[model samples]
Target: MLALRRSLIALVAIVGVVAGAVTAWVVTEASDGGAHATRGEAAIGGPFELVNTEGETVTDQDFRGRYMLLFFGFTSCPDVCPSALMDMSRALDRLADAAPAKLERVVPVFVTVDPARDDVVTMAAYVENFHPRLVGLTGTPAQLRAAADAFRVYHEKVMPETYFGGDAPERHEKGDYMMAHSAYMLLIGPSGGYVANFKHEAGPAEIAAGLREHVDAS
Candidate 1:
């Protein structure tokens, strides 16, 4: 019940610095505060067919006109998933008063890598705890795999018995037993291409700063 309040800057800062390592390259790729390049190998790619909490046929196209903050995780994750989402929610809320329409322009998403267990119903219930606007999506195994591969997310099923070296249920089942996954926060522009990326562990303020920069430009 405490997680929903969450949270980015301007155009050139958002679109142009496709490079996480090179400052000049970012300048070249983007104008004063806008991205100039059309397309490149980015965090946004691949096609997916998943259903949103509303049970609608949610696909990548649904976000055509807006910025998308996408993350790969599940409702059952014990550590990274909840912590990150909570931080994100809190960060977004702090920015709300400053940029009333920013949240509307940039949507946050939570997609379960474990679709077999994270169906529409479960995903829906879980996301609502974090933020009213956070969307949860899931689908058949096939859909899940496609999305994961596209995003370079890695998840492995470790049976409960073998999950931990033998830890408590609250420690293992809620965590170690769950699928091991790669966490990445992605930003997709209106054209459905990767423009920036915030790896898992990026602070909420950093994430909010990134989003603010990118969303304002678009």
Candidate 2:
């Protein structure tokens, strides 16, 4: 009886050690920047209601299971917006072409700041020029302000173009207005929290490299 009792105790001890080791491994992986931390810290992911390019309602919960790259810009912007989209599309293409499976796990999101100018039809037409997988969103001015607030972005319309042209104001396009804003892209994980936010002003290769760096690390 004594021998049997000792054997049972020893078996229990072994199991305890094994379980402890497994737990440590899991914790390390979850915290490792070199690993794609599932359910990462709560910063980026949250409930949001946005209008899709199709004029349909899209909520934050719709993107619960994929990595999302979100950018805030307007279609009417003279330069930054289009250039950023093009760069992002190229990066995604490179990532996809390299690893087809990654395509299923990644989603690119574009949120327009000038909702007044980016109606469903307008946003749709702009998105169509980019990759087919790209998604565009815009809503009411209230919705826009709310979303921008959530992301902590600054954007406003500017007027009085060329007012200082030697007292003879240059002719404006009448309907042409410029958006004063900054360009940056936010990257989020499956947990819907921000993992990385890279500046959209970066060159395509740099942006792509940053993405690859993170993906590879993860």
Candidate 3:
């Protein structure tokens, strides 16, 4: 009985060590970029049903056969959002002169993360400051969540006090909150597949170059 008990304990110890080793290997592989290594393409961009600036219902299918350059942010964003949109607009303008055919196939899109404050009228007024062809989209909270999740976007509302700490400015109104979101611009292929992403700091020239490259490749 003593020998049998000892053998069982030994077997359990061996099994635990093996399990730990397997777990460690998986963690190392994932950290080393093996998490996305197996897939042929990154899983990003999917079907989204939303409302356009004109108060028209739009969906991912509406952009079929056309490439989409999309960014996610709130209209009220003071810096990052406007900067990214302007860069995108400038890139499209460059493409218009450099590659008119490619520019025709591309569409710039802005999706609002703060649906509560960014209604159709607000989006309409906001997009006019960017590219002439820029399309602004907004929807209900649940609809927005679905779209954001499909694109792997992260967004959260921050209050003045929480964002500015003890010296936070007084709120202009009860709904006066700020939205924090990812600032990367995404390029989607004509068939609605993920192509590439431009960093938040990417300039208009860089974005245009990327767009030209990917559009030509597709």
lDDT of every predicted structure (CA atoms): 0.69, 0.68, 0.79
TM-score of each: 0.74, 0.71, 0.79
Task: Give the higher-lDDT candidate: 1 or 3.
Answer: 3
Superposed model 1: Cα runs more than 4 Å off: 1-39, 160-176
- Give lDDT: candidate 3, residue 35: 52
Ordered by TM-score, highest first, the candidates read 3, 1, 2
* Runs of candidate 3 exceeding 4 Å displacement: 1-39, 164-175
> Could you tell me which 10 consecutive residues in candidate 3 have the lowest summed lDDT?
19-28
lDDT of 3 by residue, 1-218 (tens): 32342344334334433343343332225765665333345567789999998899999999989999988888887667887899999999999989999999999999999999899999999999999999999999989999987876777788755444434555445557777566678888888887887766679999999988999634
Per-residue lDDT of 23 in model 1: 28
Q: Which ranges of candidate 2 are over 4 A from the true structure?
A: 1-45, 160-171, 174-176, 215-218
Positional deviation of residue 175's Cα in model 1 after best superposition, in angstroms? 14
Clashing pairs in 2: 34-217, 45-192
lDDT by residue for model 1 over 1-218, one digit each (tens)? 11211111112223323433242232234556765745235443657788899898888888888888877887887667888788778767865756767777888888888887898889888998897789888999888889877655666676545433344355444444566565557777777777677755578788888777878643
Cα RMSD, each candidate: 8.5, 19.1, 15.0
Q: Write the per-residue lDDT of candidate 2 for residues 116-195, one digit (tens) a residue.
A: 78999999999998878999999998887787655545566766352222232355556556565546676777766666
